[model samples]
Target: MRTLIFATAIRILTPLFLVFSLYILLRGHNHPGGGFIGGLMGSIAFVFHTLAHGTKQTAKSYFSLTFYKYDRKPHHNNLSHALRLLRKNIVRNKKEKPIFIWNYYLLRLRPTYLMAIGLAVAVGSGLVGLVMGKPFMAAYWLKVKIPLVGSVGTPLLFDTGVYLLVLGMVLKMVFTMSKD
Candidate 1:
């Protein structure tokens, strides 16, 4: 389903989507839009990009940008190189003389990590209220003022957690389905 029009639109619209999502996330407390909605909006950019290009191409351009290619040599096994080899997938053509290896060491921005960190942030936000002798998940505001977001609070943190969780979940699903 790759179309020239769609690809062009994606390239132009991706940044807009991300910026709008952030805006929604930051203005969530007073306005209608919040972390969950913001997260969905944010994930849509990448999902649309994936649809426009493809899984492999999107991953190569974004996720797995840095990779290594190597030929099958016996003596290339050093400590750091061996560690890299463990995460490599060897791709070969018909003759198989020149093997292409994709190393995953540089792909630190994984969806699972986002999910875990989001969950932790959400829970920790609730725990903050508990530690202050308030009920769990209660709102607790800090006495500082920020420019865009204004007062910092537990609700904002919880919203952020929801945003990350939703973004990661949707991206994970998109990536998983794209693989098939």
Candidate 2:
């Protein structure tokens, strides 16, 4: 049932998102965007994918999110939020009932698990460095000193770990939530 027009449009747009995301992440090294924003942008591809195919099929593209995982209680907390967020714009803008708002707020994690992972990674990396005997958990500086940023120090490793953790979790979250 795929229309030629829809297929052509998606084909053109997916690569566009990927290219733009790469630019943002690379340029972000000194300016604004970075791997974190890049990850979210790249993740939007799957959201668009979900729109093209149904959720069950789209789920295949998100490797980490197993469809069967929801079988234990189908209506798990995160799953509920995922469905709600995905359907929000479609329903609300279509003049649907407002009651769904209540469900949205109720199931949505206050800070979301993505944020939690970032925090944990940062803290854990820093703590581990301290135990390693480098004062202030020297991450980059412990190894070598750069120019303007001072010794990269433990903060850099902590920051890097957190950055990676945040990006991975956010990308996964956005994809899973975009299900149709």
Candidate 3:
């Protein structure tokens, strides 16, 4: 059911959707559209790509575009390589025992770890505020100037945690559904 025109249009539009999603994510703290909306927006681009290119192609493209360098080399005995192989198995479903084990690890364990990290980050941000003798989830800001991006805050970190959690959940769903 793939259309050339649809595929081409998706290829062109995906980056724009991703960029716009990031914009929404960053601006969410000060305005509307926080991590939840931004994550949905980002997932929309991948969903569109899946519709246009099929799940396997969409998953491959999404991983390659989003992650760096690991997909290029398959033989590297590293954690990233292992993760890449796991992702590959999600689409391809390799029949070998070792590969199946890896696939199980990736599908079952990795998402949990990601969710845990997201929770830790989100809670840690609030804990920082609590440690500072403020109410939980209180806003904290540092006026130090970093090049390109000036002035950072704890809200951004919390938003980032939300972003990661949403992203992991969305991707886990996508991968699981796509496997069928």
Candidate 4:
């Protein structure tokens, strides 16, 4: 049962949750919060969205591609036709819906891919220490300091890997449950 207020609140809160999750993820290495918490926070956004809308609508809106076909005129040289076509396609796609290229590629990924990539990243971070003549899973850091984030290190990469892994895991669960 979808309610107007709930859907509106979800639309407002989803982006905020995602942004806060990133903040948590970024600050995790130096502070209390880390990848696991941040990933949970990030996953909450989609979960809420799924609750507000159905899983199918949420997936279609965020995890699918919007393709537009444009045909060039043989005689017309001006850009007006192309602009018109673009406008027409945009109108046809959906009213007030924003199409972000980043969302299309990133959110469309299957949970398995996310898990594999996250595992690879986590393992690669550990291997970096071995390559540097240190013990496996040893922490390594760059000399240069980055603003806000401070020193960059292997721990950060490992945290990022954890973040992706957790996000994938939770999303997989959510999608599976939604199917039933």
Top lDDT hit = 4
Name the runs in model 4 displaced over 4 angstroms: 65-107
RMSD of each: 8.3, 15.8, 10.8, 6.8
Candidate 1 residues lying further than 4 Å off, grouped into runs, are 31-33, 60-105
Between prediction 2 and prediction 3, the one with superior lDDT is: 3
- Ranking under TM-score, best-scoring first? 4, 1, 3, 2
- What's each prediction's TM-score? 0.72, 0.42, 0.64, 0.74
Expressed as tens digits, the lDDT of each residue in 59-156 for candidate 1 is 66665545465555666667876655555534324653423444444554677777888999989999998899989999988899999789989889
The residue pairs found clashing in candidate 4 are: none
Summarize candidate 3's per-residue lDDT along 1-180 as a digit string, tens digits.
478998899999999999988877787866544777887888788778877877677655555433223233355778987787778777774565544322111222344455677778888988888999999999898888555444568887787778767766876677677763
TM-score, candidate number 2? 0.42
Model 4 weakest lDDT span, ten residues long = 98-107
User: How badly does each model clash, as a count of residue pairs?
Assistant: 0, 5, 0, 0
The CA root-mean-square deviation of candidate 3, after full C-alpha superposition on the true structure, stands at 10.8
Q: Give the winner by TM-score.
A: 4
Where is model 3 more than 4 Å wrong at Cα? 64-114, 145-150
lDDT of each: 0.82, 0.56, 0.72, 0.83
